[model samples]
Target: MVVRSLAAPPTPWSKNLVEPKIESSAFVHPFSNIIGDVTIGANVMVAPGTSIRADEGAPFYIGEGTNIQDGVVINGLEQGRVIGDDGKQYSVWIGKNTSITHMALIHGPAYVGDNCFIGFRSTVFNARIGHGCIVMMHALIQDVEVPAGKFVPSGAVITNQQQADRLPDVEADDREFARYIVGVNDALRAGYLCASDEACITSIRNELTSTSSSDSSNGSSRNISTSSMMTSPYLSQDTIAQVRNLLQQGYKIGTEHVDERKFRTGSWKSCTPITAKRESEVIAELEACMANHAGEYVRMFGIDPKGKRRVMEKIIQRPDGQQIAQPAATKENSFSGSYRSYQPSVATTSATSGQINQDTVAQVRHLIQQGFKIGTEHVDERRFRTGSWQSCTPISASSESQAISELEACMANHAGEYVRMFGIDPKGKRRVMETIIQRPGGNQIAAPSNSHRSSAFSQPQPAPTYNNKSSASSTRLQPEVVEQIRQLIAQGNRVSAEHVDQRRFRTGSWTSCGPVDSTSASAAIAAIESFLSEYEGEYVRLIGIDSNKRRILETIIQRP
Candidate 1:
């Protein structure tokens, strides 16, 4: 199982070279070593000395019935990533029926939700565990999250967030010994596929004496893709790996379809809008929108175009022996039915201050009416103009309209930078208030005075200079290339900024540091501080582009 296929060479931490989709009832182990941009899903069980690598940090997700047991070691770390329960962004996700047992070390800016159980030599770095967690033997779960159903006991260490909110909950005999190690690795993935096929022992004895078969009788061999079974003939291979993981997670690939009596009486229809953005023209317009609704039910979703919403939906064809239905994926209650879930209503929010600041809406309505809990943190404008922040994910919403609509969807998913609010204390798991709700020009920012708060987190008062009139001294960048140009202009929305120099950064030309026109991450870091104050000292660089103007990042932030 030497999967392989990312001959890396795009640096900004290896940007997509792809090829490792997996699913067709996953089972890897031929002394497993699956490489780069991995995906896996569907009854997964890669055991033998496993090493699911995604080159430097990457796509890596595992999901459906996960069980990666033997010598486990999933890697990661290039500019860290993590937000996935399919709200895209991942350098490791691993949810759905999880159980990474043996020599485990699921690294990366990881996350492990749904039915977790990492036991043997465990070590989940830059963590987040959450859903039905168990953890245990030699555990270490670093840089914490570990919330939902937590347990972690044997040699435990769970670094920070107060040892993952005092972990210790998953009982019921620790979920029946993690369901007996995922039922002995689902019977060692069906006896390693009937010891490499004898027609999978008559398809595992006709799926244990026939219960009227519903797929998974796998007499082995079936890898599906021949251009997704000749242009998606009714998708399914987990909806073509969730439409190539939501078009490599930058979203927008819709399709809908109805008829199973208007999908049980409701009216989905929609299908004519993908307008392709290459994932082979959006799976050839999602196989011509499931071959023009081949007798209805279709489904497919993922449209997040800057949260006008519609994430996680999946049907991908139905009504012919109908029994598809999976769609559970929840990370803070999946965006309430999106596909333009009618988002236009933020006329600068109100009911007396909406996106925070009316003393953070009375400190998030007195911490969810005093049961106290709510967390969040964000920063941009190049990390709050160099103050840094981060954290956002831990607002398990406990009503006050689900914690102010999850704090207005975390200030509309960090709309142009700086969002705060913490409050916590749910039975002393600390942090009792720390406001700064939404800055960078919402109430036009200015709040200073925790000894002059530039949204105080201390020592960030230096770098934001850029005023040069050339006598050569204009050096600023390299606070990690201005945080990789402020997270590539906060992950696209028609970005396009530029700046060159040093013989046009070695003749690739680039120049107009213009077009960010208030897509406001501090007006695109003040257009790279007015292009390093008009190219003060040669060798500059920058350039982000997107909205199909392609070039997504180029670096060289100021050299000379």
Candidate 2:
């Protein structure tokens, strides 16, 4: 018996013990212990309070580029565990760049593959892990085989046995166990068990086998090997041709060439294996067929399919004749002129109806032909004129031509008016006004009246002159004197329009005034009083009143 040392002699304490022999830089904590027949890899960082012990019969191999973090304990038991190939015990294979984090325990007779992250405080016992797996924190993984690219979330307790066994009265069935094993094998080949735990694998295997056995008893032979059935010679040519093409494209045939363990138990095992002579003949036939039908194949299939079939087709058809073009119609019998109609189509009705008037249509056409925008206001005004009021539609060729004629006539009549209002050429002014009014805050500017001005007057007249300078001055002051008399008459006395007119005449200086009715006199009196109170004038007076002689006549008449 070969006896080996269980532990190495302790070295002087340091913050990290990274051996020169290891390719990776591992930061091993001073408090933790690592001993005996263990190899560490590149870029590995071991955190505080971690222990790695290899005391078993087999050596422990930690793969290239892995991290073992704080408080993790990795140990191998001395007892041998059997796996694959003739009951031999092999060394534990920890794959590249895996991270085993804090407080996780990995017991040996296990294998973990590359790029895996084992989460904190998880227990992995007797497991086979595949590449790119994430075993989350606080998960209890026992007696399981985890496949590639699997994620096990935190706090999950994964047990090897099925759920039925957890019941008190339930007994494990041998048939069920056999079924479970077969189902797991099926799942592995189908790639469905990539993230399977022990219980999941067991369940899948049991279900698959049970279903398969039932199908088998019904006389269905769906699981029979493809090659077991004799091939017809007729199909052999096509089959061989297809196989040859597939192989040329880098597809592998038969289980032996690829990983045999990754394949299903009976899948493609009995197919006639590719041989050098058969391969050559198939390739030669495919090439000949492709050459014969190259033109037709190119026409029928697009570039991609034609290229693919160029190396694939074993049988091909002859090319058809050249494509023919239809004959053109003679000028005398052409349908083009007959199809032309001035009336707009139903689709164009809204676009071409009263929404675009004959005048606007003419104007728009001219502008488009000249490569200019019809003035925005011209466009807007025309929209309103045509009863649509708001819309921006592209001018049609016919409509554009019509609009040009109408715009010319409109410009001839309104050019002077436009210049007077906008102080620019009518067209330029229209464009500027549209631009200004279309701006975000342009609504603040007063909008011009939509009503058109009459063309009767081209220029405004001068101010009118009065007959006499004093009469002109008196006329100006007449409104003020009438206003004063109107105020005097309104002291609780009802005054008529004639009496107000007489009082205005009595003040000869105010002769230019017009007669006022009772309603007018009352309103005028109120207005005058309000003006005097507001202005606080000192020289305000009522003129032309009767003196003491009128009082003597009134006293004599009272005695009689």
TM-score of each prediction: 0.29, 0.26
Top candidate, metric lDDT: 1
Q: In model 2, which regions exceed 4 Å deviation?
A: 1-21, 81-91, 161-560
lDDT of 1 by residue, 197-285 (tens): 77868777877677534323543323242445435544456555555566665777776777744442235668788777655567667
The C-alpha local distance difference test score for the whole of candidate 2 amounts to 0.37
- CA lDDT of 322 in candidate 2? 24
Q: Which candidate number has the best TM-score? A: 1
Looking at model 1, residue 210 earns an lDDT score of 76
TM-score of 2: 0.26
RMSD of each: 19.7, 38.9
lDDT values, one for every candidate: 0.60, 0.37
